[model samples]
Target: MSVDINNYNPTRVLVGVPYVNTVFHFIVGGGGTTLNLTDQISNDNSIGFGKGVAWIASDQAAILANIYTSTFSSWLSSQIWVYTQLPSTSLASTPTAIIPNSQQPIPSSISSELINIVSTPSGLVVLDVSGGILFI
Candidate 1:
């Protein structure tokens, strides 16, 4: 469940698989432009994303999905960030999503971002913290 984007191409976006811990950098246009897949950082083991995908909603709107927490101590939740304007470049962008934790038989104990994401013809799907899948 991944979007296969490579290198620093501005026309495409890459959302890595669960535990892959990667997302593309973006340079947003006034009218929402195609999201880009720029540099990916793998060496930084301290931080990582579980899973997610990206898509252009319109000329001025795009959906970027990922696992995020407000702080290291905050619970990592699966969510999407609606970018009215995308960041020029930054890994610490915001994320907002609907979590599937309540559906899990056993809740996740780890207090870090641990969701996986994929795209489908229907829309975006997420593998949530407690190991359940939810369609967005």
Candidate 2:
């Protein structure tokens, strides 16, 4: 996904590999910086199967990501984690997690998986595979 963060103008593109639970930030015409999720979320034993990613309209410096987690055991679970302060240059940083919302009236709790996300001046628009739209 590509976003226009005023601080990182021109274009900031985010790439993620679910299987490896990795993410990278590439500045157009510049170098790419990898985001290490392992060190940050290892304590929680969570794996990052990136479901969605988007910049926070309220705070461009921050990003929100939807992640999946499971122990590959008899039971499984999923969760959303948040990280911040991505470095501008070399050296890997923690990958940020995401939370989405929609304009349509929705319940206080959201159980559906995030399908995609869009950032607007006001907030984020999240689309779920269940055809539900949420605005945050």
Candidate 3:
């Protein structure tokens, strides 16, 4: 079965869905944050999460992106550096999220520093790394 983000509440700290080959960027207090996706919570990609709508795609090439934070203002006050492609995993992926410098040639892969983590209070987040452009 495919995966989707069920409960991505930024205020309370829960976020995201099971997405594959996707790159998710984040913002906090008007700045960007980093999220270290953990394989610690659960391994199975089965069972549907009950609340979220179609925030992320359930297909293999879909991305589930969101802003996670405990602070209300911080959640609202951040600038996102979106990277649509999964540079680390996919070789042909192009980052539709952020535009690179015109002088610098666009690389076939996404840059590591471009992918920022979603900062939240504390909760179980998810990542699928399957494929596609990231969407919230």
Best candidate (score: lDDT):
2
Any runs in candidate 2 off by more than 4 Å, and if so which? 1-8, 30-48, 57-86, 90-109
RMSD (Å) per prediction: 9.0, 6.7, 17.4
* CA shift of 29, model 3, Å: 40
Q: Decide which is better by lDDT, 1 or 2.
A: 2
The prediction achieving the highest TM-score against the true structure is 2
Candidates sorted by lDDT, best first: 2, 1, 3
Measured with C-alpha atoms, the lDDT of residue 34 in candidate 3 is 46
Query: Model 1: clashing residue pairs?
Result: 32-59, 51-115, 51-116, 51-117, 52-117, 79-96, 79-97, 80-96
Q: Of models 1 and 3, which has the larger lDDT?
A: 1
lDDT of each: 0.41, 0.43, 0.25
- How many clashes does each candidate structure show, in the order listed? 8, 8, 14
Better of 1 and 3 by TM-score: 1
Which of the two, 2 or 3, has more TM-score? 2
